[model samples]
Target chain A: MVRWEPGTAERLQKVALELFATRGYEQTTAAEIAQAVGLTERTFFRHFSDKREVLFQGQELLVQAFLDGIEAAPEDASPFEVVACALRSAATFFPDERRPHSRTRQSVIDRNPALQEREHHKLTTLATTVATALRARGVDDVAATLAAESGATVFGIAFTRWLREERSLADIAAEVLAELLTLAARALRPAR
Target chain B: MVRWEPGTAERLQKVALELFATRGYEQTTAAEIAQAVGLTERTFFRHFSDKREVLFQGQELLVQAFLDGIEAAPEDASPFEVVACALRSAATFFPDERRPHSRTRQSVIDRNPALQEREHHKLTTLATTVATALRARGVDDVAATLAAESGATVFGIAFTRWLREERSLADIAAEVLAELLTLAARALRPAR
Candidate 1:
């Protein structure tokens, strides 16, 4: 969807979230969203199933990109390194210029409880997809799940930092993975 | 909500989840859910706002319990110790007999995309709240947030394992935290 009509789809997402933040999720309709974006209802429906999906348009791509990154990792990389590479790959997935739209999409998600739930589902899907990718690369069982999950956790911190801090996504991700390692070390204190 | 109504509300939740799984969330109504559970529509409304709320009833208490655990920790405990204690507090927050309902709740949540997102928001909220709690306990800025998020990350792995695996929640949390720490130690090795 982003590839087809990047600007229109992103603009719809931004306008929809703004409306969702101010006017509320259910109260706002497809027409209202399209009008705000200067698009027709048919154009709106072309990109989104309904108003709720505007927040989730790029989800499929994100999940696929995560899998692709894992599969594309260097053969010598450890499972953790493979996951770290996936986090780095996410840097190119979303356009940096579209932070405002991304922020608005988040705002709408924050305001709407249902949309918030869907967002979690999206991440979980990404995590599972990641795990599958890892398994394909010969890392199986709990390790795959854990690595994939670890990747998602790192991704969450990175994305949050990207939202709040004045840094590139890669730096934010690197910082999070580093801190996560520190915490994980602290968590594994030998029984004393 | 759990402290007050307990089983009646839980019964509604289970029944609603079954209905939602079978009939779809959009097709299911409050009256139908109430009928299946032998409760009145009025009682159903009392317990939940909509079909979705039924899926996320007890998570708030879980987050609250995490906060309480952090606040109740000894004066000199490190931020990591405080977060670990908070994760341990879930044992007291949920009773032993409630385990079945616990899995059922997770199953229902797993089946529904929307419910999963709500669960994720609750998790992110829990992490932030725990970080804020640690700050109040005298931990400084980046360290406090890092500790909180790391705890949240470990807790997530623990919680996900607890829900899926037959092991006790406390046990899985302890193991994941331990393993994550080992992983982090390896990651933090200084470059030659």
Candidate 2:
């Protein structure tokens, strides 16, 4: 097993986001980011593959959290229940302590169209992953896809709100999921 | 109003997809695509801003179809009803006659990560456009977002099926939307 360097990656990510935010993502270099954290350029490369990777670090862990959430749900849980569990579980990855960091990271991503596209791609991948997990649990293909994609949409909206609001990420995600369910129900109602 | 050059854009897109498929997207150039269509590079530039644009031509029309669908729905239609109407309207843009062309275009996009990212971005934009249209019709913010996103997901899955199945895009999208609603209801049900 690879010995994980715990704080190094997190430190590099935090420093990189700060530099990217202040100097502009395009203006900042890997070397400059590494220097800001008192690390050598080579040390920075050891933690991240590229400058963009810094902003996207921990994505795998986030995806895994969603998957783990799926795994942790009750075996007899409804598809929506499974998804709700997953969202609540994934929200643990972004506690109150991470709000400022997330906000800065989002700000950096928003200014760059390329980064925004990358973020979109990531969310699409997350939805696909969640759908596959549901399928593994015996959910039908279309149903699994709809639930997973809806879950992704809920998570995304909630995450954005969490960055700006005082509420915890878990609380925000739960409320968002409830709102989504309510909206879906309202839409499904027959027109008078 | 500017006089439209009929058949030019469609013809260029066809030739470009063929070249991108057989010759590889990276190997083909805008000039070559134009030449294959018996047009000058300037004319090609007039049709598309870049080589990648050839595969994505008519996206604006597709978005417009969705918006028009929203507008065509009854003023008192539920959010889901509005989305369903929009999806059906958008399906008219992907008739059976266009499936082979769409398949070829999608195949070419599948092989290129950059093109895939562009497609994701386009879908995101479509959802946002649909949501805004719903909001204009007085749908609540989260309801509009959920309905629009669900509509986009239904469209995407149905479009994939349309490429391979004998069913019309409209039929497939309507069925898919129905399936999604059913899934959402199932998930929302209290666990036994």
The two-chain DockQ for each candidate, comma-separated, is: 0.30, 0.65
lDDT score for residue B29 of model 2: 92
lDDT of 1 by residue, A24-71 (tens): 788999999999978899999998998778777767788777767776
Residue A83 CA displacement from its true place in model 2, Å: 0.9
Candidate 2, residue B25: Cα displacement in angstroms equals 2.7
Weakest ten-residue segment in model 1 chain A by summed lDDT: A183-192
- TM-score of chain A for the candidates in order shown: 0.87, 0.93
Residue A176, candidate 2: Cα error in Å is 1.6
Candidate 1 whole-model C-alpha lDDT, 0 to 1: 0.74
Candidate 1 lDDT over B47-67, as tens digits, reads 888777887666678888887
* Predicted complex 2: DockQ: 0.65
Compared with the true structure, what per-residue lDDT tens digits does model 2 show for residues A1-192? 112345978788878888889999999999998888799999999978899998887688889999999999999887888999999888888878778878999999999988997897788999999999999999988888888998999988888889889999899898888777766677678757
Question: Could you list the chain B TM-scores for each candidate?
Answer: 0.85, 0.94
Residue A185 shift from truth in candidate 1, angstroms: 2.4
Task: Please identify model 1 stretches exceeding 4 Å from their true place.
Answer: A1-39, A52-55, A94-96, A100-117, A189-192, B1-61, B72-76, B94-125, B140-153, B156-167, B190-192
